[model samples]
Target: FFGDYPREMREMLSSNLPKFTSEEKRLLQNKADFIGVNHYTAIYAKDCISSPCDIKTYEGNAMVQAVGERDGVAIGRPTAFHGYYDVPEGMELIVRYVNQRYKNTPVYITENG
Candidate 1:
């Protein structure tokens, strides 16, 4: 649950979090009946807020540095595309997360192999 601020998010991105206007917040409430999730693979997450990361990326906004491997072991089966892995379990986890976060909203797997 989120209030004016999310505890976990605020712990990493304090002032970086955007302030939403009342109109925007109102518009966002129950805006979608279904949620579409585009999942590729799972990875190891590092707290870039506490440590250093080489490349700044979209995930960096959440202060998470994602890597495909840990301790020389890959997170999942490597795919032909770089950074994309074949991790079927990730799909289940992501969908479950969406269901919980979106109050069991109908979910569509928008993108997958």
Candidate 2:
């Protein structure tokens, strides 16, 4: 994940994403002992590439349009934060996803709301 950008990110951002030199790539190999995950909630992601969107959202850089609702239904219980939602299951999903991606790297839930 360090030598080159992930395929999805590359596809979305292309040249906007940075490239690493040989020295940087060597330093990144087997470097991390763990991964810190800060998961709050999961939002529905619409492909902005296929649909109209402002393309100025937090996820716009990923070519994804994120929304808290679908078919006028909220994804989960609302939280104090405007966009953050109360979705406990999301935490497990996120941790599991990270574990799979990092492959044996210890994952810590550094923050949750």
**Top model number, TM-score:** 2
Expressed as tens digits, the lDDT of each residue in 1-113 for candidate 1 is 23346678777677788877877667666767788888877888877767887766764575677899987989899999999788889999988888888795789999987
The local lDDT score (0 to 100) that residue 88 gets in candidate 1 is: 86
- TM value for model 2: 0.81
The local lDDT score (0 to 100) that residue 102 gets in candidate 2 is 78
- lDDT of model 1 at residue 56? 68
Tell me how many clashing residue pairs each candidate has.
0, 0
TM-score between candidate 1 and the true structure: 0.76
CA RMSD of each candidate after superposition: 3.0, 2.5
The reply for model 2, stretches above 4 Å from the true place, is: 57-62
**Per-model lDDT:** 0.79, 0.79
